[model samples]
Target: MRRGRAKSIPKSQTRRPAEAAGEVARLRQELQEARALLRELAEGGGSVVAKRLASLEEERQIARGQAVEAAMAKSKAEGELRRLQAAIDKAPGFQGWLLRRARRRLETG
Candidate 1:
């Protein structure tokens, strides 16, 4: 009769539990470090995100003001054109005189 040999388990498998625990602890430490960095960035004077938001708001206000100014100027010009057209319709010779006066004023100014 031949003698039978016992099978042996690998050494790495035997040490797997401790290695896994160490890996978990290291990962947890890294996570804590990341969280701390985030907290620090948030608590400091100002973050990049906050600065960008402020700049964007300022630009938005400037754009809104410009839009209002443009609307007012357009309304003013339209009113002047209508008034000038009415005057020209009422007096045939007035349009040429008004044009000459405008040109003279522009040249002088």
Candidate 2:
């Protein structure tokens, strides 16, 4: 019985030139497709962000208007309260009945 030695092939001969070229072309096509997808996503995402920013701006304006209105209403209410307090302080009380009676007599005369 005879033992045969296996032939050693070089690393460069492992893949043919045509096969390597085809692989390179396939990889390049995939890269182009990936870039196109990324561009499409970026454009779409920009619009979404813009719309969200606009919505937030509108909400902020509405909130500011409401805050201003609330402040004005509070100031008006405080003024009314102060006027009422001053009027009550100047009005005659039960302890000043004589003064009230004198004023009534003066008015009648």
Candidate 3:
């Protein structure tokens, strides 16, 4: 099994321009559809649709906020994991320590 960290591929190499463009286009279409729906509800003067839209917008905002909070927590955990790994590395190589212990035992015997 591979130990420690693997090298990261560069963004330019890893990401496809066409895929990113497609994602952006999809998001724009979704936004346009939401706007059209809102306009239709306004034109019909449907209070129910308006109320529902407002509720949905509120929920979307809360969910977005929670996502940002979760991302921050994940980032903090990753940083702490790296710090502890570095500390462990500094303590001494495990194989070398075991070999040194064996040498000391043979000498004493």
Query: Between which residue pairs do clashes occur in model 3?
Result: none
Clashes of each: 0, 0, 0
- How many clashes show up in model 1? 0
Q: Each model's C-alpha lDDT?
A: 0.83, 0.83, 0.83
Model 3 lDDT at residue 37: 84
Total backbone clashes of candidate 2, pairs 3 or more residues apart or in separate chains: 0
Pairs in clash, predicted candidate 2: none
Candidate 1 lowest-lDDT run of ten: 84-93
Q: Write the per-residue lDDT of candidate 2 for residues 1-109, one digit (tens) a residue.
A: 8779878898867998899899999999999999997887687978867888999999999999999999999999999978855655566777356555666687699
- In TM-score terms, candidate 3 sits at 0.44
Model 1, position 90, has a per-residue lDDT of: 60
Write down the TM-score of every candidate.
0.44, 0.48, 0.44
- Candidate 1 lDDT (Cα, 0 to 1): 0.83
Q: Please give the lDDT score for candidate 3.
A: 0.83
lDDT of model 1 at position 18: 82
